[model samples]
Target: MTQPSQGVRRSYGVKAAPYGFLLPAAALFVLFFALPIGYAVWLSFHRIEVKGLGLGKGSRSEVWAGLENYTSALTDSELAHSALRILGYGAIVVPVMLGLALFFALLLDSERVRARSFARLAIFLPYAVPGVIAALLWGFLYLPDVSPFHYLLDALGLPQPDLMDGGPLYFSMANIAVWGGTGFNMIVIYTALRSLPNEVYEAAKLDGCSQLQIALRIKIPMVAPSLVLTFFFSIIATLQVFNEPTTLRPLTNGIPTTWSPLMKVYNDAFTGGNIYAASATAVVLALATFVLSFALLRLSNRRTTQGATR
Candidate 1:
């Protein structure tokens, strides 16, 4: 068979170079991601067989378990409860956090706002601190004894409710998430806001639009991409909430070992001495996070396109 002409051969050879460059990345992907995922899948579907007195090398064998692990995880009421708690927590955290972020961002963008530099830096400074440390600080503050709120209430002769227990614990936890998250989300949105052309706003002002109208109509819609970005990340962060609640565990008796899905996975993997189950739960959580994020992104993107068309 005749090979391609010289020009055609050179064109093919030039086109092939990019794939040749990508070969290393492909290899690393298989080595790191694909291999580990496949191994996890294998482990998720199998259990160790303990024989005799469970003391010998042959005492343990890898055996197939079908969907027993998955079914068990799905039916697990504790996991379900943890998931529901997180859902409620996210419902509170995401909207409030994003709303505050947008508000602060708009304030920062406002020309008449005083001390914008100081306020912006002060707000964003919390993002520099670790989540564990942030939770620890807030956990103390939420304690009635250590809280200034309680002190103020005491001076006014008011009762101090138990913040480290019951429904308040959810808000306390959500507060930590909001505090740590708000600054970063604000910066994302503020950066988007800063990129807006002055001419558009000037023209809007030339028309009959008030400052509030300009902000509500032009500024918010313009920064929809950043809002989408922060929303996506907030959902991921909310679902994987572990560190804050775990840190607060020392301060409160209310938080269980399985307070969050990640905490449950940690308990199963380490405390419960069931790495396989933990891995399975982790995989399931990860899959759920991905699916939810994907669905939300699709919905957001559709709405965004429809708004743009209008």
Candidate 2:
């Protein structure tokens, strides 16, 4: 047989190289993400049945639950309450966090801003901290005895309100998320701002537009994609809030084990020992996330297309 031509070998190598490079990533994705999700989905439709007073291996068996778990999760008042709490939390978090992120990004991009580098680093520093650690740190700051705000109120002879109770608890939790997240979102928006053509700003200036006017008109519109991206992540993160409230739980009675949907899933799986129910709730939350994310993206795309057409 004739040896393969150099061109044939080269073409084969070119075709094979991309797959070779992707192999590791594909394997890891399957092993870690895809397999786990598939397993959870399988577990969601199963329940463990106990027999003979649950005493031996033969006493326990896995049985098909069909949509029983889903039905239970859907009808669960605790789950519904948790869902509402998260929605309320997201209402406070997504807007306030993204607004501050946008403001800081625009401020850092402004020509008159001082200590720009230091300010950016300071804002983004909290992003470096782990979510659990950030929650713990903020939890301490909310404590009446240790909190500086409480100390200030004492000094001024005013009533010091509990930060971890009632209406204040929502803001307390929101504040932790905002503080930890705003910096990262700001960096994303700031990077997008920096990518815009300077000519746009110059043209606006030549047209007698002030800095604020240029920001409101040109800068914001230019970075709308980044804003949408940040908003999407913020909404997801707000919905999945667990660490902040969980950490604060020990400090106050306001936070329950099922304070958020994700937390409710956790409680069902571990604390309540109902893995099937937990899996079903997790699947529901995941589906809701996908639906909301797709809807938002579609809306954003429609708006973008309409804007471009005009």
Candidate 3:
């Protein structure tokens, strides 16, 4: 028989093999995620201390600023306006995108719908297009001289509104997001719909249920998991609205450097040369994202449990 010491050694080896394999991933998480996060948090609490013409040895120092950065960030009216602008943008993008996705998914799932393959491909084509290119294409389309919309409006003697200006810019940008995102979300929902057992639908039909009744009762309920997942991701994406606006910046005068929160952070860091404040804003944004995500997950879990019990 093996000695107890040898047996213990062998057991330890067996248990440790998995951890040894996981070591690389753990190291990467520490180096890339944990380390940078810790650094950012440390920086957020401090600012540059400049002395005497801001040049010489010991001239630049990082002094503790406590909650000064947070206070300033909170009180900045520009940031407040950006937040409200994003809120309005999100209000439009989230519902309209998800609604169109859900509608397209349902239509695709229905047996009577024709040319689904072609329609699906056409809709999903935008996902392959780069965000910059997509924005540029739409940017030109929104312009008076270049747009077919302008020609049609002029022919009809109707007023042609600039899509990239003022209040309409929200809708314009939201449209880009919806067009690019809907097909992907639709596919996710449609896959869930397809996975449902046929017997459930057959039973509903036998009970004198109409198509709409069957979908509302069975299909939508069954696909709630996918819907929740989509909604969560959509929320995150909406909150990080940067690329579309940035791309459109060169083509239009309306989008300021501080159009979105992320954009604001970028401008502060690069243009304003204020890395300390940028770090603070970035940390705040990350915290907000985590809180929102946690809240969404909890709400989804509660709803799921209540639904399951019923």
Candidate 4:
């Protein structure tokens, strides 16, 4: 047998190189992300059945549940209530957090602003803190006894209402998410802003466009893609809200074990000892996230195409 020509070998190497480099990533993705998701999906349609005294080798067995688990999860009032709570929470969080992020990014990008570096770092510092730790820290500050707002109100002889109860609890939870998240989103938006061409600004300036007008008409529209990306992640994060409320639950009675849809899944899987139901709920949540994300992306793409055509 004779060896292949150098040209043939080089061509083969070129074709194989890309796949070789991608092999590790593809393997890891299958082993980690894909496998776990597939397992969860499988579990969603299965339940455990106990036979006889439930002590022998064949006593406990996995059985197909069909859509029973999905049906139960859909009709679950607690889950529905949790979903509503998260919707309200997201309503408060996504807008306020992204708005502040955009505002801060604009301010940081402004040539007129002083101390831009210091301000940017100061705003972004919270992103360095872990989500659990941030929730714990904010949980302390929300307590009436330790809260500065409560102290101020007390000192001024004003109403020092409970921040952990009723309507204020929503704001309390929203504040924790916003504080931890705004900085990261701001960095994303600011990076997008920084990537814009300086020529655009010069032209706007030549046209007598004010800073506000340039930002509103040029910067914001240009960075709309980044905004859409941030909004997509924010919605997913909001729907899967678990850490803050779970961390705060021990501190107050206002938060329940099923305070959010993710928390409800947690309760069902571990606390309630119903893995089938939990898996179904998780699958449902995943589907909802995908649907909403796709819808938002399509809407954004449509608008972007329209803007480009105009």
Candidate 5:
């Protein structure tokens, strides 16, 4: 074969360099994400068949199950209830968390705000705590005996509503999530607010606009993309909520073993010893998350495109 020119060799190297750099990430994705998802899907379509007493090696074998598992998962009452509960939970968490985050971010970005570093740290400290630990800490506070709120209520002779049961339980569960999640979302919004050009604010001020007007008109609209990002994350987190409810379950009668869909999946797989059913439930949850996330992204893109055209 004829020798390749130096330019051709350099061109080959240039073309291959990006792939070489991407190899590690691509390999990691395949090994961790893609492979595991594939296995879960494969397992979801298969079930164990037991012959006779199932005492021998050949007694039990894996067999194709088709849509049986999916049908069961879809029609499950527990899963349906859990889905409804999470819908209520997300309704509370998403708006409240994002609202508080946006509020705090606006405060932090203000000129007159004192002790900004301390404020930021205080707001963000909850996020640094592990979800399980945060749940435990909040769980302790929710108990009537140990909780200061209950103590104060008793001292004032007010009715002490149980935080662990009935309608109050929704707020109780949501509070832990809000307490832990608000800080991180606040930081995201704050970072975005900080990135905004100061000239816009200056122009708004020069036009005799007040702080509130500047915030509503300029700041919020400017940081909308960040809001959308935090909203997306909150949605995903709300869908996959497991640790908080699971950790708090021991402390409360309100929380069942299947309080969340993921909890149900865990109960089915390990506690119930039905991996195929769990796998099916998991695949369904994954698909729902993907659909919602993509839909949100598309909505966001549509809005952005409209804004650009305007």
Candidate 6:
């Protein structure tokens, strides 16, 4: 048989080029993400059965557990409490973080703002700090004996409040999240704002709109997609909160071993030596995240469609 012509070979090469470039990424995704998730799902459906004295190889065997692990995880009271705590934490972190992000983004985009680069850096600097280090730093600051706030309060003869426990603890945790997250979200919103056409702003200004009016009526609506993106990520991060609380746990008793769902998963797997249950709980949490994220996207799309129609 005659070999294919060079023109046909070139066409084939061009057609295959994109997939060739994407091959490494696709391989990495399958190897790292897909396989691990598949294994976790498999593990979630199986359990170790201990037999006789549970001392020999034959004494323990893997057996089908069906939905037993999922049921136990769902009915777990500790998990319920942890979920409630996350809801409250999300309530605080999401709005405050996104609000500050949008506010900073708007400020940075403003023409009258001075030292914009320095101001942007100052706002985003906290995000550069590692979460564990930030948590530890703030944890020490929450201590009355070592904190400057405590010293100021002492000099003023004022009562010092314990920030590491009770109601203050929520704010304590939320503050860390807000500090770390706001900057990243702000950059995203700022980039979105910068992409907006200057003609719209010029027209609005020609119509006698003030800066505040332009931002409120024009900039915000134009940047709704960025806001929604930030909101989605904030929700995901709040749901998966582990580092800050876990780091600060040594400083206070307010945070439990199962403070968040991810924390609970860690404690169950390594600490409790029950990987099966942990896998089930993790799967459940992943499902919940997917559901909530999907719902938010749907709601956002619907609103965007409505706005476009009008």
Query: In candidate 1, what are the lDDT values of residues 25-111, reduced to their tens digit?
Result: 999999999998888777788777899999988898879988878887888899999999999999999999999999999999998
For model 3, residues 1-310, the per-residue Cα lDDT tens digits are 5699899999999999999999999999999999999998888899998999887999999899999898888888888888888999999989998898888888888989999999888877887888778888898899899999999999999999989889999999998998888888998999999999999999999999999998888899899999999999899998888989999988789999999999999999999999889888988888888899999999999989997899
Model 6 stretches with alpha carbons more than 4 Å out: 1-3
Q: How does each model score on lDDT? A: 0.91, 0.94, 0.90, 0.94, 0.95, 0.95
- Backbone clash pairs for candidate 4 read none
The digit string of per-residue lDDT tens for model 2 on 174-226 reads: 99999999999999999999999999999999999999999999999999999
Name the regions of candidate 4 deviating beyond 4 angstroms: 1-7, 52-57
Q: Estimate each model's TM-score.
A: 0.89, 0.97, 0.91, 0.95, 0.94, 0.97
Worst 10 residues of 1 by lDDT: 1-10
TM-score of 5: 0.94
* Count of backbone clashes, every candidate in sequence: 0, 0, 0, 0, 0, 0
Worst 10 residues of 6 by lDDT: 1-10
* C-alpha root-mean-square deviation, each candidate: 3.5, 1.2, 2.3, 1.7, 1.9, 1.3
lDDT of 5 by residue, 1-310 (tens): 3356877889999999999999999999999999999999999999999999999889999999999999999999999999999999999989999999999999999999999999999999999999999999999999998999999999999999998988888898899999999999999999999999989999999999999999999999899999999999999999999998898899987899998999999999999999999999999999999999999999999999999899
| TM-score of candidate 2 against the unseen true structure | 0.97
Candidate 4: tens digits of C-alpha lDDT, residues 197-232 = 999999999999999999999999999999999999
| Residue 103, candidate 5: C-alpha displacement in angstroms | 0.2
Deviation from native of the Cα of residue 64 in model 5, angstroms: 0.4
Model 6 Cα lDDT, one tens digit per residue, 183-270: 9999999999999999999999999999999999999999999999999999999999999989999988888999999999999999
Candidate 4 C-alpha error for residue 195, in Å: 1.5
How close to the true structure is residue 88 of candidate 1, measured as C-alpha lDDT? Answer: 90
